[model samples]
Target chain A: MEGLWALISDDLPALQIAVPLLAATLCVLIRRPTAAWAVAMVVAWSSFANAGVLLHRVLTTGTISYVEGGWPVPWGIELRIDLLNALVLLVVTGICAIVLLAAPRSIDAEIPRDKQYLFYAVYLLCMTGLAGMTVTGDAFNIFVFLEISSLSSYALVSQGRTPRALTAAIQYLVMGTIGGTFILLGIGMLYMVTGTLNIVDLANQLALVGPNRTVMVAAACIAMGVGIKLAVFPLHIWLPNAYTYAPAIVTAFIAATSTKVAYYVLVRFAFSIFRINQTFDGAHSSAIAMMLGIAAMFAGSLVAIYQDDVKRMLAYSSVAQIGYMILGLSFANEYGLTGGLVHLFNHAIMKCGLFLVLACVLLRMGSTRLSAFAGLGRRMPLTFAAFVLGGLSLVGVPLTVGFVSKWYLVLGALEAGLWPVAVLILLSSILALVYIWRVVEVGYFKAPPEGADAITEAPFSMLLPTWILIGSTLVFGVWTSLSVGVASAAARMLIGGGS
Target chain B: MIEWGLYNYWVVIFLMMTGLYVVIARGNLIKKIIGLNIFQVSVIMFYVSMGKVRGGTAPIEAAGFEVYSNPLPHVLMLTAIVVGVATSALALALVVRIKETYGTIEEDEIRRIEADEDAS
Candidate 1:
């Protein structure tokens, strides 16, 4: 049993990807949608368990490097686990497990009966892709896994019954392809200069080659590509529609995981692979990123204020929250980077909880329009309570994970002597408060429209997962042992420099 | 002489810009997809060019062929080609669905129709 545990521990990273992919294939073979969902749930929960084990291993043993097929690094594909990847792996699989738990009931409600199994299969493929992207050490392999996740998400987005979903999927495909192509072009340029595709190896070579035009161009291309995927301010045209038009559960899962992974990729490239600050162009890139981050914070929130649809509003809020994450990254110090990394976890929980609450409301109300939520506080008290709590978290209210993230972010800024940036961070939360308060006002104060009084609370399954995530925002908010400790360790590892 | 050696990059950049132009300028969905294909093909070309060695033969493990081309980029390009094909297929399928519902494949037309629907 000890030996078996050792073997599984050594191979956990590969299993994290293989299990979900194998389950995805098994789901295709299964006839019943319920059976397929069962297969997915078991795989997802097991993956979550495996990810927890990996995180524990990393926390204890430091970095674990797994090379495929026993081939050494620089020759074979590598999956390296450090504190950062381990933290993200736990969050990604954790969110996958929570969302899958809530999926069956919502999938039945939203997806066609005949196609439900296919949705589960594709959903697992997406999980496999996201996990693969997070763990891989090869630069080109990141592009491959990126396409896998993006293609699966495109399919999942288009699965909704609305014709608008088809359009949204098409738009997403175009934009995503452009992003992927730019990344590939950038990769090719970097390879041309360094003659290597392995990330750690490329970092070593880049250190010797120093900064040049080709390297800067490569960095620019990669940044823009990831920026589009991360939905940084002006390049965020593809996000709101995709979020609004995708099916409820699909929106929930993708909203929680996809852009978070993209942001992770951005951090990997800038800090680990390129070491952007070491180059001559480092200050330029950081400045531009900071500018865009500030803009996205304001613009995404301001746009979120006017959205009539609850899902769309939350989607815009996600954009704003992504800005806060980016702002932390741009600070380039341990405290700032810790805030960024911690916000990744906090925002995923905060946003995913809110979307899951929206799923609950959508299941009961049949519409997510602001008007449909009138007097929902009384009609569906538990679900609305989750929403209110999630909204408060998004506004950075104390005793929530959002407040913890913002506190560190403000500290990081003040440490950097950027007082105005700190002020802006606080101001944006006030903006967040305004947007969230709009829904609260309507939910609690307004009268239920005609025929709305009889609408019941969401089913227990949906509310359970929603409240679990909402509760964690409070738990991690106060404890700070796990989230903060891990985030600060990951930040130290990143800022300490070198891959 | 210097410009001549860098001609491949020039051609690659031109093709890339043209493809992006078509994608951004054209309203027709099919044309946009074709443009995307062109853009991706330019990337494929860029990568394949990276592996090229002057006077190098095919990257076979035989004895007298000393200056061999890099095989890694070729392998990566194969994966990239597969990704491009998958994206194009998905895009075309979505375009088919868009046409079925909106009665047109033009971007502006779809927006206009949606706007009018929203207005009414």
Candidate 2:
């Protein structure tokens, strides 16, 4: 038993990725949807446990690296875990478990009867892909896992009942393929120059090769590819429809985790693998990131204001939130990266909470239109209260996780002496307030339609998960040590200790 | 001779640009997927080309084989080709669904249908 425990602990990172994949296959074999969900639940919770154990190990010890097949570096794939990746793994798997707990009813409502098991199967695959992408230290391995996630995400999005879901899935496929191809091209270019694909080795070798035209082009291709995947600013055309059209659980899970993982890849590339400070190309790339980050913050918020569908509005808001994250990274400073990394955690909580509440509202009332939200505060008090709090967090009100992330972002902007960017960050939060308030006003102050007066609360299962996320927003808001401390460590490790 | 050697890159650039143009310019869903396929194929070709070291032969291990082609990019592109195939299949399935729902697979027609839905 002691030996078995040692094996599990030593192999936790690989198990965190592998267990979900194995469970995914098992889910496909299971014909009953409920049974599939049970398998996924066991798998998801075990992954969450693995992430916890891995985080504890990384925190207690140091960075952990596992090479596949006992092959040394440069000859085999390595799964490396540091503070940043461990935290991201925790967030991805933790939220995935919570979302899966809330999924059975939502899946029942949103998907056809026979296809429900397949949904769980695909969900596990998506989860495995996401966790795999987060843990792998190989550059090309990122692409493989990225496609694994992207392909499953396309199928997951298409499982929605609305026909528009199909279009949204296709749209994402086109954009995602282009993005993945660009990333592959970038990796290929890097391999051509450096003759290595392990990220750490690539970074060391790049120090010798220095910046050339091919390196510059490779950098551009990778940034563009990851930018699209993260849906940073101008490349976010596909996100809104995909989020708006996918099933509520799908939207919540993917929205909370996938883009965060993609952003992790972007940050990993820019700061760690490429070591942006060491090359001239890094400066140009950071400039573009800053420009697009600012653009996305303004454009996404402004477009969100006019959207009548709450789901669509929240989707746009996510784009703006992504902008904030990218803006944090653009600064290339410790505080800036901290802000970015913490926001990745905080935004996942708030948005997952917010979207889960939206799902509750959708489950109660058939639609998610702004008009359908009328008097929901009185009718569905628990769910709307969660929404209001989540919305407050989204607007970066004090004492919410959103505020902690934004405060660091503003401080970073100020420290960088970009006062205008600081002001714009504040201004975008106000824009967030306006859009969030639109729903709050319509929900709380307005009257329900005549026949809808008898609407009640969301089910206990859904409400439980929604509140768990909402409660975290408040808990982590007050105690900054968990999110902020980990984030600062991650930031220092990423920027202060890079190749 | 330098220009002759570098023309390979120029041809790659040309194919890539043409594929990207078709993807962006075309309105038909099927055409867009086809264009996307073209774009991906260009990338695959580029990867294959990058693996071809000038004096390298097939990477079979024998006593005298000193110059072997970089097998990594070729292996990477094989994975990429599978990804490309999966994406195209998913895209085509989505197109079929789009046709069923909107009665047309043209981008403009889908937009018109959605806009009409929005108006009412």
Q: Model 2 over residues A389-483: C-alpha lDDT tens digits?
A: 99999999999999999999998898788999999999999999999999999989999999886688999999999999999999999999979
Best candidate according to DockQ: 1
- lDDT tens digits, residue span B6-48, model 2: 5666777888888899999999988898889889988888888
Show the lowest summed lDDT stretch of 10 residues, model 2 chain A: A277-286
Query: A41-62 in candidate 1: lDDT tens per residue?
Result: 8999998999888889888988
| Candidate 1 deviant stretches above 4 angstroms | A1-7, B1-3
Model 2 pairs whose backbones collide: none
DockQ of every candidate structure:
0.92, 0.82
